[model samples]
Target: MEPPRDAKLLDPTTQPARIRAMYTDPDFVRRGLGRAILARCEGAARAAGFRSVEMMATLAGEPLYQACGYAAIAPVRSAPVEGVTVPLIRMGKWL
Candidate 1:
């Protein structure tokens, strides 16, 4: 069974595969699942011949990605979703 926290498969692209989404249940936060899932994504990307893994990190999630060795590529940007614009940071990790 999947853990309460989960990561989506990377999106195929000409550049690095992008982590489509990742979420951890609030009740299960800070239990290392996020880091584990991130590692799995990187491992998968590397196995697939990708040189890097990228993602758009939610404002709240940015710190977690950063702590896992992802480097920021640009300043934060806004994306409108569900009638509100949320800040997201572009981050990538070399595989």
Candidate 2:
């Protein structure tokens, strides 16, 4: 499924590598599944010697990511989702 509005803040120029899209089903969002998936992804990146990972975040997800230690790399920006506009923030964490 396509991300919602506010899901477009990912700037390829600012990313360590091209950002890959990821998401958790809404029903599983509060069950720690998102964190688990992020942990696994980070672990694999770390094992591969990657120093960091990055993502563009929706307003709904920013807090959860922050709780996991991801921090903003830049101010929030406006992103278009479908034909709608939404706020987005660029975030990253060293692995």
Candidate 3:
């Protein structure tokens, strides 16, 4: 996956790695793929010197994140897209 937006401009030792996106095939849901991927992401972030990881998670994804030990930071609304908006939760975990 691509590095988080503007990653080069941020200091890994001070800034959290942004988990820009994550997905699993519907047929593979609940089969541990998400958890595995998340673990890998955290490992990569930690290895890169990031102190934490964060993301704006859709409601459908919030449960999985929560189950994996991420804490909800706040509720946020995505910027309008062609007059539509999405509800999301900001969540993070220390690595």
Candidate 4:
């Protein structure tokens, strides 16, 4: 997906790596599984010379991202789907 139009990054010209569609099964919640996945992704991004990472987070996932050191970088945006809207926050972290 393209970067958000109103993204405010440390380097606007440098496109940060993106993480998408991350989730943990309800049965596996609180098992540190999500954090492990995020660590691996961040490691790979850093290995590839990326200085940062970003993702559009659902309200349910926002707490985890914040706990992992990602901060909100933009205002909440609505994603329309089948006549419904999902609130998403643009969050990012420097590697």
TM-score for each candidate, following the candidate numbering: 0.78, 0.70, 0.88, 0.82
lDDT of 4 by residue, 67-87 (tens): 999999986767555667778
Model 1 CA deviation exceeding 4 Å by range:
1-14, 76-78
- After the best TM-score superposition of candidate 3, give how far the Cα of residue 94 lies from its true spot, in angstroms: 0.7
**Predicted candidate 1 versus true structure: per-residue lDDT over 1-95, tens digit per residue:** 22364355544445687787799999999999999999998888878878888898988898999899888897675655556767778999877
Compute the lDDT of residue 93 as modeled in candidate 4. Answer: 98
Residue 10 shift from truth in candidate 4, angstroms: 16
**Positional deviation of 95 in candidate 1, in angstroms?**
1.0
Clashes of each: 0, 0, 0, 0
Q: For each candidate, what is the lDDT? A: 0.81, 0.74, 0.90, 0.87
Q: Which residue pairs in model 4 clash with each other? A: none
List where candidate 3 sits over 4 angstroms from the true fold. Answer: 1-7
TM-score of model 1 (CA atoms): 0.78
Model 4 TM-score, 2 decimals: 0.82
Q: What is the lDDT, from 0 to 100, of the residue 13 in candidate 3?
A: 75
lDDT of 3 by residue, 5-62 (tens): 5535557977788887799999999899999999999999888889999999999999
Candidates ranked by lDDT, best first? Answer: 3, 4, 1, 2
> Model 3 scores what on Cα lDDT?
0.90
| Model 2 CA RMSD to the hidden true structure, in angstroms | 6.1
lDDT, candidate 2, at 7: 48
Per-residue lDDT of candidate 2, residues 1-95 (tens digit): 45555645544334453235668788777899888878887887666566778888887888888999999877576655567777778898876
